[model samples]
Target chain A: MNPAAPRPAEPSASAQAVTELLERSRALTTPALRAAVGRLAPPMDTVAAYHFGWIDADGRPTEADSGKAVRPALALLSAEAAGAAAEVGVPGAVAVELVHNFSLLHDDLMDGDEQRRHRDTVWKVHGPAQAILVGDALFALAGELILAAGDDATAARAARRLAAASRQLIDGQAQDIAFEHRERVSVDECLTMEGNKTGALLACAASIGAVLGGADERLADALDTYGRHLGLAFQAVDDLLGIWGDPRSTGKLTWSDLRQRKKSLPVVAAMAADGPAAGRLTALLTADAKKSREEFEDFDEAEFAARAALIEEAGGRQWTADEARRQYDTAVGALAGVELPAATRERLTALADFVVVRSK
Target chain B: MNPAAPRPAEPSASAQAVTELLERSRALTTPALRAAVGRLAPPMDTVAAYHFGWIDADGRPTEADSGKAVRPALALLSAEAAGAAAEVGVPGAVAVELVHNFSLLHDDLMDGDEQRRHRDTVWKVHGPAQAILVGDALFALAGELILAAGDDATAARAARRLAAASRQLIDGQAQDIAFEHRERVSVDECLTMEGNKTGALLACAASIGAVLGGADERLADALDTYGRHLGLAFQAVDDLLGIWGDPRSTGKLTWSDLRQRKKSLPVVAAMAADGPAAGRLTALLTADAKKSREEFEDFDEAEFAARAALIEEAGGRQWTADEARRQYDTAVGALAGVELPAATRERLTALADFVVVRSK
Candidate 1:
């Protein structure tokens, strides 16, 4: 939401205030979600609780490490930026978070990645059975959370957009999974998949914020574009770091993408090349049935270097970063179109940058 | 659902008319669900289309081995029984099916089941990620379909019940998974879990039927009971055949339940028994690790025998069958409570018996 004119307080209070506002956002969501969840089909509480990270195996609370709550921030910030009342944004907070969590619950299962945010993926820990239910539960809750926003036709419109975006998100994830098994992946196809996978929810987040701001479809569409850019930038940076960043800092195995022969932009371009580097990469990737860790590690190093070289030669890496900047510019352009409160717009811009700049 | 009043009719006409009516049900649901699936949700159409057995991997019309249309049957039957206008029950038919399919999508994932109705389960083929997205897609459609019952209020209420039931179904599935690892799984717990897992949706099917009929809460409650009893009876019969029935006929691996150490009623009772029988049963169940085919075969024979012996001794199998009978009685009692045509009541009774008496 737009920051109000300075309340004669030092700037030092901003971070603490932001954290507390986030905490309040979460607190507001819990009861609202709980009430909505209660109305869901029976036995749904378990899935709901698990998705929220409230209960472990025995259904007891140990610790909570939910995601970064990025979507909610986008939503509330956009709403406030547009000068919507704070109360109006509070409930939408739940809608955005629910949608975000729902995606996570489903995406983890589809991606087949075993670890997320340093925790055993829900499916791995609780089995796919519960994970599926958990995802379904969140899906149901997310719909109700938005619908229960009741009278605000804008909110309802926002809910419809959220649903539409969810469909795109699902489709994007499918392309990503398909990319893993496909023989060749073009940059265009990868961009399309990444947009759907990452951009859809972020767009919904910002769009919902605009709706809360009483912005018309015109404003909402622009905000959607803004979020889409943020999402694109987010993925591009993540891909870059996946190969070059400190492994410990990134919290992922070093050269793990190359070792796994992931179809990331660099690897795909490198593999498409018809040179010794490509041949070596292909030989390592398509070798005999079995592969040992030592062999994989050595191959991973060579492939990583080759792919980096290919990225430079083809300008693929720069191209990705440039696209991110285009998205960023588009996002900023959209902000200019809206007559939002300056301070709130500034916060949203910062949040947009934060999306692409996260270390882990 | 109740049947229409009996009347003399030519055999050819009756058979022809019945086929038309059955096809009519398919006609109502197909479009509602299909329209809800957008190009954005790629694998949703794939997974859902697969569940219906409508398309092969490449997405083409095949022989539709869609589920037996059980939920729709109840809706239409209830509507006909109540003599409600077609407009009322028609949308309910679509709603119930959507809810049923939505549950099936998640249930398959939660159970870690690899196949369903002779096809690869959603998670197995599409992977958990797409399976989850598909399930969510189905859920959104279910709500949307329910809300199609004319006007926001009626649709909202109907959708609310469905949302509630979806939660319970998920919760029940979670309890089922949790029971798998627990040391002591009481008979009551299994029964309760089964109720949530199976009965909740069945109850919802009938309740939706009543709602379509414009039946009051009492009538809806009666349908709910009928659905609950029928669900339990259905599970009891399934458990019975899991051990004693011919695998060729049932199309399941013979005595697969025992091999899996499933805590069916007889097994639970046997485990709860005194002395040697209980000890032997405990020894078999506490070993959840994989078993040799021979060991499994031995356990199969022993489990079948032990269950029969316990059913004979503790009267558990007889008790289970009796419970089935009790549920059937309650269903009939529920039917009695509803003010439908005499012929309709008889048909519902016949259907109830058919549900209980079936071996497969």
Candidate 2:
């Protein structure tokens, strides 16, 4: 979005490789995921199926976007990093995916998001009650899947990890909601919120496969660190896209996060910068928020465009872009600490790169 | 409300014994429960603490009713039934309690209930978002607790049982909500819904301790049957209280279920009866529902009292009372099929009796 920010040229080969990995992971994970969801009772199962894009709202089969399945890919690759076949991580992959979707379902409702992946959100389609129940059902399924995947000790350990991460993720959401009512939030506070909201689950997804495959804690910890850094990079890119990415590509409205008055990285960083542009941006946002309190649809595209320019002028966009690159390198560096196979390490690096650079 | 419905006499000795059992179970479970909740991050822990009545809205310590601890007592007794110390069932007891409270937190929000236990509901005190997140956190804690309770096999078995029952519980809620919009719900359908909603969890609570203590499935099955019947009895009594119990004792308004237009057992059974009173009751309910759709809170005390009298005259009150007694006998009979210590059997019978006859 910022002309001064360096854009990494996408190598077609690396992009193709990551695409293949994601597809393979989805292929391995979908059957199990569908099976787990199928276990939900009637009407709930139908609502969940619609949310997953496996069927239309009318109950007929249809193909639609079901997210990138990034978490599942990480899980499968993590198992291989632990010296097991990808199939060994199928349960973990499915569990991570279920948890991810569960969060998506709830977050969309809480955030009042009407659309996801260019389709109506579950709450918009099925009403808030069903959305809440289906999300809860998916979470329960994740716990069941992880607990049944291995022997008692392994299952217990994995369940504990998932539970801890899920708690952090929920806590992060609580903080994010709290931040919306405040006038100012520091960069450090924003980072902490993002770390819990995004980093914890990604870390769990990366290490859970190793835990399920019986890898030692050292290897799992290394993968966790790798995924944590990758999540920061991923979220930074997401913040940038929320402001400036094309609505068609992002499958979201222009300035989506700003519309919700989210205290995401770009806004927090912009306000932290020292400049007249920052002050002007702050004054504009403060006034707009007051108006929004009475009439929520007060902002127009022109206003959002002006705010985006002010953010770039104040260095928020460039700083966020730089931060994404820095975190991506740190994530790749984390892999050097562990003794993974050369192919596994390369695949992990490629996946991290893809996450930081993808359009959606 | 109906003069013809027989009231079961409460024997002081049995009441005292059941109260002691509940107290002992709570004493054993509260510490572990507190410890688990203490692990939640800031603000969430506080919200949960308030919900549990450990603290009031302002965060000061307070002693308030934390339910009857019925499920925990059942769990401990089931463990003893399996030849294990009551201590062995503490984890299962704690998990079941957490799940029960989790459901309450979410249900209060979904049902828009503002009062519970003679105090404000969590959603009313905190916002809906916090209510949702805290409920989710509690549910996750439950899975973790049960999985960590015993050896891998035992933990996994217990988790599966809990998950199955949780799903049924959720499904029953969905059915209940659906029934609210329907014109007529058959009595059989109402029973099935109640079985899934209430019976499943009670059955799990009755058998989980046995499962954790490594008891055979046959014994667990017997206990499951006992709890299932007891749950039906328990629900029947709850349905009665929903309509006619004193507000001071029940912590609910008069005709609370009727206010929400819930087609509970009384209404469903009354509709099924053949008589002029049944026809008049149905006509009044349908007209009231239509009025309620346009402006809720349209019905006054006089109209509700009239409807209650009609329901009683239609034989709903007597039928539900007879059904509660029938289910109580069936539950007690199920206990006889399994070999139990005479004292354990007596305690179980007393607890069931307590449940069927409690004021709240």
Candidate 3:
């Protein structure tokens, strides 16, 4: 049973529930996001608009795949969980979306990725300098939107949470970049890096609305823990898809992470495993690294398939799937520690399920 | 006399007065700035420390030439002008400095500049990815610092001001990059870019302290106007130094802007002049542009010197000097519109005077 295979047309109740939540989030959040981005000056504004899928390269309007809007959904739901109307969380939602996209724009440039969401990246479309500038603009706009969202104190608290998470996100990117050059990386170190790269912002998104709504630290921390675990689960699933998911669904080539030589969870876990398979896998990767010293892109598909098989034979695939399930359970368990409404808890739980099972 | 020539050891009264204020501002602001940067995780903290001259690249302590701290002085003094103690403005000062340095780090990479303040730039020493990430960390730190500084309302207001200025600064950079590709840039266009690139942040620095101190918009606006004019004056003088100043004093090569084909104030002003020399300059620049299309750095010293002479003969240098003095007068005049303690008013005036006439 390949997890990446297409499912039946009839969606499960949990999946249906999350689809509505995400749609609602996009409906409420995109306008605020548009308004904030509209405040930017030309060229930077144009680059950002193109980046956000509001316009095409020639400046014509087009509704493209912006993203899943999962972070915004979490923010809005977090507000509802705190007993405030979802409207109260709009600013937080917009700010988180902006930060997420800002990171995406810069990351695409730094990672040398030419495409995102089936379209050319900002850097590829409008030179690298514009990519850097537009990203900076969006980051500034995020801070501005949060700061102006409410009374001075509430806004400051919300902004502080967002800022801390953004710093962690950047630090994570630095660590990920550093990891690519090292020959050995522990599973723990890889998890820590992923926690910073993916978990920090998700945790902030899950609780920033509560912060804005003046929720107590204990409740917010519980939500934060839930989001963090969910992010790790999300990443674990993503790692699995990187090697095995269908290109039609994932919008990536087969063995994408392996090709990029990313020290993702499965790769690290596989390397850490004991057995002749793991040793053979390590030796193969070492030889590949040496052979691809000048051009990593020249590796053949058969070689990648062999590496994937080796990772699976060494139990990396099973370990990652188990880890994803464990993390999802822990994430759902976190909501139980806080006295959230049953409906809110169910919705959050459904969102986590959607994250783990997402094919794209 | 050459305006860039070193001055005598004996300083004038106004210069002496402003020097003491800057020293005092740095003394108060550095500890807070250091503390804010210290909050960053390792690698980022290390890169930022090296950039700030707090530490050498090898991780040893070294008090290198950190910048003049002019923006922080303006912030601290703005607080005092609003009837608050200078300490009340420390956060604002630190935030502005952080934003300023953040731009510098990104700008150095975007501009491909290897040196700043006589040392290798962050990108040069640590590579482009770290430069980008560390700059982002600093920018996030700036927002966090401002938001945590005071009551929610005050902090939010201050953060909004910083955010607006930051966006404008980014827009200016975008425009500057665009100008490099354009064949003609008007003097007015150059001035607007300079204002956005240089004036917006200066304006924010001059007013953020007052915003933090709970001053009304009237006083803040007045200070903003003052700083805007002062910044233009500073840029005009900087344009002069870029072309004619002693490299030893300015820490740049002679004809630096010319070598880069920067359409700075003097070049724009000269091209706009209705004279044979201006026409000849334009033609020469056009030919040079075509010749150096493949390699911009290949222009000889004789060509740059000739371009500089043509600009001066066409009245670019004289016009820029007059413009700098005019802006300085206007900046000083803005202080008179707002009622402030006489000492505070005098200090601002002295600072403006120093900016217009400084050799470096």
Q: Please tell me which predicted candidate would have the highest DockQ against the true structure.
A: 3
TM-score of each: 0.77, 0.91, 0.93
Per-residue C-alpha lDDT of model 2 across residues B79-194, encoded as one tens digit per residue: 98888888888888888888888889888888888999899999999988888888888888888788788886788778888877787788888888888778889999999999
Quantify all predictions' global Cα lDDT against the true fold: 0.65, 0.86, 0.87
Model 3, span A1-360: residue lDDT tens:
234222244348878999999999999998888888888887777889999999999999999988889999999999988988888889999999889988998899888899898899999999888888899999988888888777777887888889888988988898888887788889999898889999999999999898887788898899999989889988998999998888888989989989888778888899999999899999988776665545777778998999999999998888888888888888888888788878988889888878877888
Interface Cα RMSD, each model: 4.1, 1.9, 1.2
**RMSD to native for every prediction?**
6.5, 3.2, 3.1
- Per-residue C-alpha lDDT of model 1 across residues A36-80, encoded as one tens digit per residue: 655544345665665676767567875667666667777777677
lDDT of 1: 0.65
Model 3 Cα lDDT, one tens digit per residue, B1-360: 234222244348888999999999999999999998888877788999999998888989998988777899999999988899988999999999999999999999999889999999999899888888889989988988888887878887888889889988998998999898888999999999999999999999999998877789899999999999889988999999999988888889989898888999999999999989999999988776675545767667887899999999999999998888788777878888788978888888778867877888
> In candidate 2 chain B, where is summed lDDT lowest over 10 consecutive residues?
B1-10
Candidate 1, position A145, lDDT: 65
Q: Model 1: DockQ against the native?
A: 0.28
Error of 2 at B37 (Å): 2.7
Q: Candidate 3 falls in which docking quality class?
A: medium
Better of 2 and 3 by TM-score: 3
DockQ for every model comes to: 0.28, 0.50, 0.69
State residue B208's C-alpha deviation in candidate 1, in Å: 3.6
